[model samples]
Target: MKKGRNELLAEEEKILAPYAVSSRNSGSRAYEEPEHPYRLPFQRDKDRIIHSHAFKRLEYKTQVFVYSEGDHFRNRLTHTLEVAGISKTISKVLGLNEDLSETIALAHDLGHSPFGHAGQEALAELMKDKGGFEHNKQSLRVVQKLERRYPDFPGLNLCEETLLGIMKHGGGYETTQLLEVRRTLGPSLEALVVDVSDEITYSAHDTEDGLESGLLKLEDVKQLSIWKRIESSLPNSEKKSDLHSHSISRSIGRVLLNLMVSDLVDTTHQTLSKHKIESRESIAKAYQNKIKLVHFSEEFQKEFTELKQYLFQNLYRHPEVSRMSERGKETIYLLFKHFETHPESIPESYRKREGEDGRMRIICDYIAGMTDRYAIEKLKREGILWFPY
Candidate 1:
């Protein structure tokens, strides 16, 4: 027999923790529609996110490396998938809503600019006075206004809980356009799981990419506390001295992921118990009282922070990475300048909204939606960037 939506909701009630946001309690969508006969609300949201045009563009958007850098490096799409995977694992083990966690993870980076943080910084500087550019806010805007999939709504019209999870992932909820999302309460446990999963995925995967690209030396990486701990844990037979770089990088990535996830799950369980967060209402109450119930322990946190700092110094700031970052920023700046002076060059869809949203914002929206290759190709095609003979 096929399990209907009611059956799934029942199963969630039985299986998920009391604090987990079940489909039955999911907040209403901005625009109400009949529920699916077989799919849960969060499951539907995950599907909607996967099908969105902006989600597809993530494939060419940067994570730590540009699309042209290489095929093997992690791009925004791969990074999002990894976050979703990790979030689901953490949420399931903790008896939280895995579907909601995965949905939030999938949508977290939808607003990221084409060239990763470099592109975001460029856009931020360009629009500093024009309300500024933050990827999290932009991501909310993308789901709430920019996407035009439905005839009746401007955006995806995602469930209110899903939207809240997205808005609260990176911490600030005061600026959210959703009136129903309470700023007093912190994000749900599912959302918190997604947030931590994002950190874990990036810190580990970026290191792997850096090592694989030879931007980070094995010797330098081995000096980090987290790496040292991981190395010491490995048996002598598995720790071959002359393993290939790719093999070594993969091994390090797998171990790092396991360490972070295991620590987070165990510590979070202890946190939930300490705070007495037995019900959804108590979760909100705990947040109102400023209790953080989802995080790594103090000891593991210091080690993880050290790993991030090392990556920031050695991998993210490497000369080659910086050169590409600068080039990407320059591309965005030049394109924005050209479009500002010549609004006619922008697409008709964006141009049509100039009166209501203003010209600068419209321009930002258009550029923010572009893929790295699209932006670069457009620049070359316009003769803004000349090719040497």
Candidate 2:
């Protein structure tokens, strides 16, 4: 006999840690619907996010490089998948809710514009007066109001726990105003796991992408404290001359990911123990008192921070990357201006709802949903630019 939803819920209650958020205790959705016969709430949420149009659009969106940069580079969708994988590993190790963590990881970047941070910056400047645009807020908006998948509801109508995890992961000031969460308490352990997993995935993978692109050299990065630490930990035979070769960049990325994940898991266990956080309520109390329950040790954190700083100085700020960023910003600015001046050019579905959502916001939403290729093609169609970069 196959297990049903009740059986799965019972398993979660028995197997998950005391601090984990079980499906039975998950709060109601914005719009109520009958529960599935075999799928748990968080599991259903994961499926819903996976099938959303916004999620699909991530494939063509930028991560560190534009879509045209190369086929091997990580796009937003790939990065999201990596975050989900790492978060699930950490959550399972910590006995937290892996399903909720994975769902939050998958949805975290849905609101990012076409060209990564550069595109988001352009939109933020354009929407400054209308109400500043941040990707996290846009992500919430995407799930809550923008997506039109169901006849009975406007958006995905995700369970409140999933929604709360998404909102809390961003740690924006606006989270305070939401009545469902208390201002003093931090998010669930599942959310914290996803947040750290995101950091780990991006830092490690961006380094690999930078090395692969030839924008960052192995010699320069190997001098970083984190790299040296990872190097020292390798087996004696594996630490031979070939380890320093550029060909080992992928190997380095793998080792760095393992080191970080191991450090985080062990350190978090110690944190929970130190704070006496054996139950969900105790975890909340610890957070209310400003204790961090999920993080690396102080020594590891310093090394990780140094690694990020080195990447920022050497890779993310490379002339090639800056050039790409400038081009992306220009493209976003042109698209926003053109659409604002000619709202009729927008699809009939969006144009029809302009009065309800406001013209500027409607335009923003339309542009935000575009893939990098789509935005570039649209610009070419409008004769805004003659040549593609």
Candidate 3:
């Protein structure tokens, strides 16, 4: 006997917290369709995100290091997977809907440009007079209008809840495009969990990648209070070799993950108790009142901020990273300017579609969707690489 969607919904109602957004309670999509018989709405949304063209493109997208730099560094795809994994873990511990959390985590970065933040900055600067480029807004656009998957709908036509979660996760650029999702003040618990998980992942994994790439030295990290604490906790006999350095980074990641998750759960539970938030409606009211329920403790927040500042000063701003970023920015800028003058080279779907912002936005979409290799190839194809500007 097969357990159907109804059974799954029933199980979710029994297990999920009163404030969790269950599949059964999901809002309708723009173009309404019959619910799936075999799977919940969130589950179907998750599957849709996994199969989308944008998801596959993430493989060649940058996460600090471009694909040509090294195969070992984390691409957008791996980073998304890591965020999903951590989000699900935290969601499970907090009694939230794991499917919803995982779905949002997976789709959170779908709007990132080819060369990561550097590429995004370039695009944003180019379109500064226009609507401007924001990855979070672009993410919303990907699901809402860009993806042409269905006959009845232009985009994926995902559940409203799933769309909202993706838009609110990570607290990035906000969008007013969707009137339905516009009023939300804070994200749901599941989305909040994903956001924190995203923070945990990059703060730790980027450090690991930096160390592995020789851009960041082990001695430099030891000066940070958090790293010192994590390093000292290791066994005294552990020799300080490459393996030792790797272990220290991993330990720092693990310790920070555990510490943040624990504090978040505890703080959230306390807030929920203090406010007596027993239902979805009450949770919404809490958010409307500007109360952020999911959060690390005050002590941990300071430490995390300090760690981020240290990383920004040392790792992210290192000369090697900065140089690569500059190259990436220049690459995106040239590709965009080339396509602007040569619109025929742009693809049909992106070009033909009557977007809200017109040709410039359409061009922006085409460039934003490109992978690192694709962008580089496009630049080379136009013979733009030969110029020594």
Candidate with the greatest lDDT versus the true structure: 1
- lDDT per residue for candidate 3 within 1-389, as digits (tens), equals 78987787897889898888888777788898988888888888999899999999999999988888888889999999999998998888778899999999989999899989998899989989987988987988898888888888888998878887877534345445454353553567888788788888898788778777777777777776666556655555443546545665565566666666777788878888889887777877887888878887787778778888977888778888888889888888888888888888888887786365588899999999999888888877877763321
What's model 2's overall lDDT?
A: 0.86
TM-score of each: 0.96, 0.95, 0.93
Please name the candidate that would achieve the greatest TM-score relative to the true structure.
Answer: 1
Task: Count residue pairs with overlapping backbones in model 3.
Answer: 0
How many clashing pairs per prediction, in order? 0, 0, 0
At residue 66, what lDDT does model 2 achieve?
Answer: 93
What does candidate 1's lDDT look like per residue over 1-389, in tens digits? Answer: 89988788888889899889989888898898999999999999999999999999999998988888899999999999999999999999999999999999999999999889999999999998987888988888899999988899889989988988888544333454563455655678998888899999999999889988989888888777787778976656548855445877877888899999999999999999988888877888987888888899899999999999999999889998998898889889999999999888899999999999999999999999999999998898777873321
Better of 1 and 3 by TM-score: 1
Query: What overall lDDT goes with each candidate model?
Result: 0.88, 0.86, 0.81
Per-residue alpha-carbon lDDT of model 2 for 241-328, expressed as tens digits? 5644655777778888999999999999998888878776887788778888999999999999999998889877889988988898
In the predicted model 1, the residue pairs found to clash are none
